[model samples]
Target: MGVRVLGPRDLSAARAVIARDPVVNVFVDSLVQTSGLDPRRGAEVWGYVEKGVLEALCHAGGNMVPVGAGEAALRAFAAYALRRGRNCFQILGPARAVEVLWEALEPHWGPAREVRDDQPFMVIDGPPVITPDPLVRAVEPVELPILYPACVAMYTEEVGVPPQTGPDGTFYRSRVAELIRTGRAFARIEDGKVVFKAEIGSVGTGVCQIQGVWVDPERRGEGLAAPGMAAVVELARQLTPVVTLYVNAFNTPARAAYERVGFRTVETFATILF
Candidate 1:
């Protein structure tokens, strides 16, 4: 098997490998197009091939590097990362794959820090039922000013870490705003108050990613999450055939909420923060 940096010439083969991997949710087609448009800010995606048939792949974006594959493929990908000056790497795959890769690399990289425990990723194949209760309404563009604060509050209360303000906030806000402005975000408001929200990202031919899901603590247990998430799923279905989202493994409440909306656990991914 040979590992190589993927370019425009290798895009077709690289996409095939990603499509074969059930756990890959980044929508390789959209990534390739976006990367091609702006080569400098694009993430580096590597493909592993044997006899010219792609078998595995990995993605490195900024400080986050997600490596997914078997032992041999992972080792080869790791070497490629090392050669490219990547010090920190995050492996997002099954628990067994993560265990194997971490064990193999520990000796050379000191100790691998378990930044976060395994996270459960939920995938929705069909339309989600809009549950009755808590009154959900689609948010308007004018409500973003209010929605942003509520989202930050919800994230802080549930995740224990407040959303970063200033440039960090700007980064996230701008990204979400861009998605919303482009009709990719949906909000669930209760009595004119933004209680929950979800957004779609990285759309491809057959897949779309659902991200930035949040619910206000005050509105918890009222059964608003299912319909709130369903709104995003409904929106995604309009653009793609499938929808997927990732959640922190330890967050049981979020998992339960998503399950109620017809999302099933498809895989586990680790989020390595440096």
Candidate 2:
């Protein structure tokens, strides 16, 4: 009947809702798995209740993501988010749910920096069809210098803004380093330069999400993506059963590469970026 911020006591209920579509909800699920619905850990999960049943949920933090949200739930989440005054840089979810949430927030949070309405949510559970790139391997802490610039370039190109603005990229730098430390960062570094790179951005018990996929601009069109991705997928599946990612629909070349690696469009995602 209404939405409320969830906590550790609500973890089981919240996770039940997330498990409704594990792949599509992997990002939020991973957050819950890692943080256990504890807001102090950095983010909050908002749960919508209908007659005492936790029916839908939204992960509220740097990225506001909804899981299994229908129109009614989306509206409730929007009101809650509007009251919180838009702390997140983006609102993303299933295409229709994101549309509904954006429609509700547009009155107050109007004029988003960008609205990506057609992002294909792709997934690959089995081994990749293409040959794995032998050069692609887990990045080491010592290789952070080579990998950092590539991560920045990729973020700027894909998201239209650098991950950090100030001269010090410490926050973003630490994130990349953490991924490397945990063996989640992968890249093909040749001659002290990163040719291709990606990270296992989120990891749930049964699924993992890939993000920040970037190929060196000068090295594009050389058929490196598919094989590089194959290597990443080959490695990622070791931690989880499924690997998933979402790409802007307009990026045909990237889409083609993903398809060549055997990723299929399982759902459509939309993002309203602030």
Candidate 3:
């Protein structure tokens, strides 16, 4: 088997490999489109080909962000990425592969901080039991003031970064609005106030990724996440056979809520932010 940088000629095979793994595939497609990063540039999607058959795939781009793949293929891909002088790397994949890659690369990049711990990439199958919540519903166009604050609060509190403001805020809002425009955003409103929100990202090959799940602090103990999440899952299921989302390993409450909504842990991934 041999490994090499993906070129335009490799798109067909690359697409096929991506299609086989929908969660990572959707994320890759979204990154290519939303981040304005050209997959044809420093970006490379490497495949392990044996006897004219592609058996494994790995992707590296933009500071060497690495997504999951087979161990042998990833090791080969990392060799190529390091040759380009990319020291910083992020690995989102199975726990074993991550541990192996991190150990192998320690000689080059030193110790890697666990920016995101070994959290599960969960998938929701079957109809979700969305409990009735007076505060949960679809967000409307006229409720930006109510909705924006709730979103900002959740983003800052849960994500540990202040909500983007000014130009950055504009970009963030536009990105969210694009998702809403594409029928991806869902919310729960009570007394005309938005309290919780969730959205699914791009859908391809029967897999949709859930993103930006949030709830008002005051509404946390009220059991609002499951239903709000359920609504999003139900909506995404229209386009795909399964819905997937990632949660921080340390956030037990969020993990419990997701499990209540029929999501099961499938794989553990590490997000290394430098």
- Who wins the lDDT comparison? 2
Error of 2 at 42 (Å): 1.9
Estimate, for each residue in 1-274, the C-alpha lDDT of model 1 and write its tens digit.
7787777777766666666653354654567657752346577777778886777766655433334467788777767765676444355555555555555555665354545557786788887864533444455677778677776665565445765455645865776567767787677765667778777767765777876687777778877777777666777788877888888867787888788888888777665433
Q: Which ten residues in a row have the lowest lDDT in candidate 3?
A: 31-40
Best by TM-score: 2
Residue pairs clashing in model 1 are 119-249
TM-score against native, each model: 0.80, 0.97, 0.79
What lDDT is obtained when candidate 2 is compared to the true structure? 0.92
Candidates by TM-score, descending order: 2, 1, 3
Task: Give the TM-score (vs. native) of candidate 2.
Answer: 0.97
Q: How many residue-pair clashes does candidate 2 contain?
A: 2
Deviating ranges (above 4 Å) for candidate 1: 27-29, 63-68, 87-91, 104-114, 130-139, 151-169, 190-193
Per-residue alpha-carbon lDDT of candidate 3 for residues 7-116, written as tens digits (9 for 90 to 100): 66656665666667666556765554342334545456666676786766655653343443677766776676567655343565556666666666767875655356
- Please give the clash total of every predicted structure, in order: 1, 2, 3
| Candidate 2 error regions (>4 Å) | 165-168
Q: Which model, 2 or 3, shows the larger TM-score?
A: 2
Off by over 4 Å in 3: 1-3, 23-26, 29-53, 61-68, 87-89, 110-113, 130-135, 140-149, 162-169, 191-193
